[model samples]
Target: MSINLEGFVRRKTKLKLGGKEWIFNELSLADFARLRAKMAKERKVNLAERRKQLIEEAKGIGDIDPLKLLEHLDKPVTDEEMDAEMESIEGVGYMAYLSLKYAYPEVTEEDALKMLSIDKIEVVVGAMMGGLSGDKKKPKAKAKPV
Candidate 1:
């Protein structure tokens, strides 16, 4: 029997082949690997164009070390650590990070957070918000009828 994996709880308890109850906390290495590989395959099935765009954005960053960035993101990094790591990368900003993330898919929330911390990302967001503010528009005065 198959259970809906997307739900909070798994429905099926027994594996037909092993004739044993399948427990989340007690999954074997092979079973876990199989599940992970299935998820990864699903994620990449139709993302070629998006992946290309992310690669282009990374290329524009010049020397930010994509592999290391991916590694850093895969493992959790502290906010302070992120600040120190990105401090010296020229033109690396919040907007650029967002663009990069938009183009490429992240496997975890930590990776998503790392993309948000880019300097260009902040500048781009600020500009976008600034343009939407209505504070600069003045109210028109009403004329009295004679």
Candidate 2:
């Protein structure tokens, strides 16, 4: 029997953070490849090593005059504005980076945080794997005439 592998399609969903909403697309194959590469680059010996690296990274993040990292993640927080609140919005940035990636638009950190849910990572992973596996139902075969 010939294999049919044509049901996979990318999906998009609406995500609301704080008071704002944005469209988040399911991870494409290309996006998964990129994520894999990024993870490889960021891998550490252990959780402790990863934490130490993140702490050092945060110090460099603080030295910047503007919150460029947030901007890179398509977040709207500016250095001047963030300075007033002095809040660390890295979690929100990470969510956006993973979910939206290059298509992420400017969103406030507060709004982004509001959109984040505990199950978001699981949902994204599910979506990614679902896309890979083609979860849609296949058509039933017809019986030949007796």
* TM-score for all models, in order of appearance: 0.23, 0.36
lDDT of 1 by residue, 61-117 (tens): 887665654453343334454345334332223222332332344424344344343
Give the lDDT of residue 75 in candidate 1.
Answer: 37
lDDT of each: 0.38, 0.48
For model 2 the TM-score comes to 0.36
Which stretches in model 1 have alpha-carbon errors above 4 Å? 1-28, 62-146
Q: How many clashes (backbone N, Cα, C below 3 Å) per candidate? A: 11, 1
Best by TM-score: 2
**C-alpha-based local distance difference test score of model 1:** 0.38
RMSD of each: 20.9, 15.6
Q: Over 4 Å off in model 2, which ranges? A: 1-10, 44-96, 106-115, 119-146
What lDDT tens digits, residue by residue, belong to model 2 across residues 28-135?
566545544443344322444645555667677786533343334333344454333312344334444555543465655454455666555444334434443323
